[model samples]
Target: MKGVVIIPTYNERENIIPRSGGRRNASQYGIIDAVHKNLPQADVLIVDDASPDGTADVVKQKMKRDPKLHLIEREGKLGLGTAYIRGFGWALEHGYDYAFEMDADFSHDPADLPRFIAEIQKGADLVIGSRYMPGGGVVDWPAKRMILSHYANIYARFGTAAPIKDMTAGFKCYRTEVFKHIRMQEIETDGYGFQIEIDYRVWRAGFRVREIPIIFRDRRMGVSKLNKRIVWQALFLVPRLGLWNLWR
Candidate 1:
């Protein structure tokens, strides 16, 4: 399936548009550029959540020069999941073959996007850039952060009984068929909980889901949108989402 990478941005002024030298965390800088540079054929959709720092402007500027780049400007700061849902609708309407969920802040490696697109082309309905798997890992984080992130995915899999290793992984590719099977309006969660909910629905619909290993690098340009409350909400919501399937 032909695909476009949907990058959700919220106050990513530091990294949204390339200024002189732009933002970098070394390894992260390399991986993000890998896809933006090498995968020139794929379209990139940026959904900016009303960043005051003119993040959308930067994208607009880039859009003038790059046909692959597109932007959707929202009025206020919306959550990550909602921005992606919006982007997905845009992609589907635009006749894209595949839809992707990624972050503009660089947490999810862009270089791994090609792998997800490849999986979609190979007939997997969904592909994830996983961090907890054998070849994948989180770099530059301390033990506690690693444990929380690792076990969160573990708990998500167990709670939702999802076969995939990393249910909460944000970097994912969905075939157009998968999007067709699911109800976008039915999605209720706006934060981290949204990740598990959609994946659970995809699984319930009997779509193939696969995980690819990727070295997740830390974002050096901006503050993380991840919060303690959202973490707690995700901890509580995964099993609830499993139960939500019955209602659907």
Candidate 2:
């Protein structure tokens, strides 16, 4: 099965730098290498939002060497949702059977790429890498942040009634058919809310969703993009989607 991993980036130069330690080390190069190591058939699409830190340059350098590496350089710092949407469109145009959403900061493990594909082959339309599920958890996060994430998931689940344990999960694999059915142009939420919104839409469309336990490690390099505005967006968007679902 042909698959493509869509990694959205914004100033991820440090995260993508090649380090000599090991595969456990976080870097964009490490992510691409790990994905190929685990699933050689899968390709990577780096959707860069005009990173001022020369992140796109790094990807271009690698692209010259790796034929499977693809890139889409946007003009500026577009939101996360738009970045992934652009990548998803590219994946579809290229005829990829499966499309994946992953982080460039290495918070999501590349090793699990194969596992997601395995689940997709088993008839799952959307496979989520869930940190809230059994045998799944986060590492090195502060208690306050953990509490916020945990409750955010709870709130999203209750509000959307999406039957997903990790409503805010960013790491996921989707069968191309899911996107073919959903109206992508209508999705507006960005940041973490983007994850919740997509999951709710897919569930509402009656697709089979599956969750696989995954350990989410905080980014070892660079700063996180989470902000108060993002938090608020998610808080309001969940109930809005819920009400929309009921109305429909």
Candidate 3:
């Protein structure tokens, strides 16, 4: 399946806007920087949330020169899941075979993208870049935040009963059919919860889900978007999906 990776950015200019790390942020995993570098064959769909720091400006300048990059500017800071949903639909309309979700702040390493694509080639409909698995880890996060994040993924997995290690993981690749049948419009989470919903749906549908180890480095620049509101949404939505799916 021909594929595209959709990254939603709010304010990542400080980290990637520079001339050096630009390559690290652009290139796909395996050898070097993934987001800003060398995936010449794949298209990058960046959905910017109107970041005040001129993140879109950087992408636009890059796009002017790099034919592989594309941008979608939203009016303001919309929810995370909606941005991805919009991107998914756009990818579908464009007839892309595989769709991906990742972060702009480097929290979800761009270098791991090629790994996601490689797993897709192996017949896995949903390939997750998991941090809890072997060789996967977090760097520079406070111990409290790390624990909170670790258990959140754990809680989402247990509550949803997804047969996976990290259900809340945003780094994922989906076959077109996964998006085609999931009834994305009905997915109500709109935030990080939306990610949980998608993971549960894909698992319930019996699609092949595989976990690939990845070292998730904390972003050296830009503010993170995760917050109590997103956490609350995930906590509230997981049980609902779990209970509802129990009867399905």
Model 2, residue 200: C-alpha shift (Å): 0.3
Stretches of candidate 3 exceeding 4 Å from the true structure:
19-33, 36-38
Q: For each candidate, give its TM-score against the true structure.
A: 0.90, 0.95, 0.89
RMSD of each: 2.7, 2.0, 3.2
lDDT of 2 at 70: 93
Give one digit per residue, the lDDT tens place, for model 2 in 1-248: 88899999998877666555556533435666767777789899999999989999988888888999999999998799999888888988999999999998878888788889889989999999999989999999989889999999999999988899998999999999889898999988898899999999899999999999999998868887888988999999988988997899
Estimate the TM-score for candidate 1.
0.90
lDDT of each: 0.77, 0.89, 0.78
State the lDDT of candidate 1 residue by residue for 173-244, as single tens digits: 888778888997888676667888888889889999888987877775777677887787787788787676
Per-residue CA lDDT of model 3 for 151-208, tens digit only, reads 8888887788887887767888888778887878888686668878888888887889
How high is the lDDT of residue 1 in model 1? 43
In terms of TM-score, which candidate is strongest?
A: 2
Off by over 4 Å in 2: 19-29
Reference-based lDDT, residue 247, model 2: 94
Q: Is candidate 1 or candidate 2 better by TM-score?
A: 2
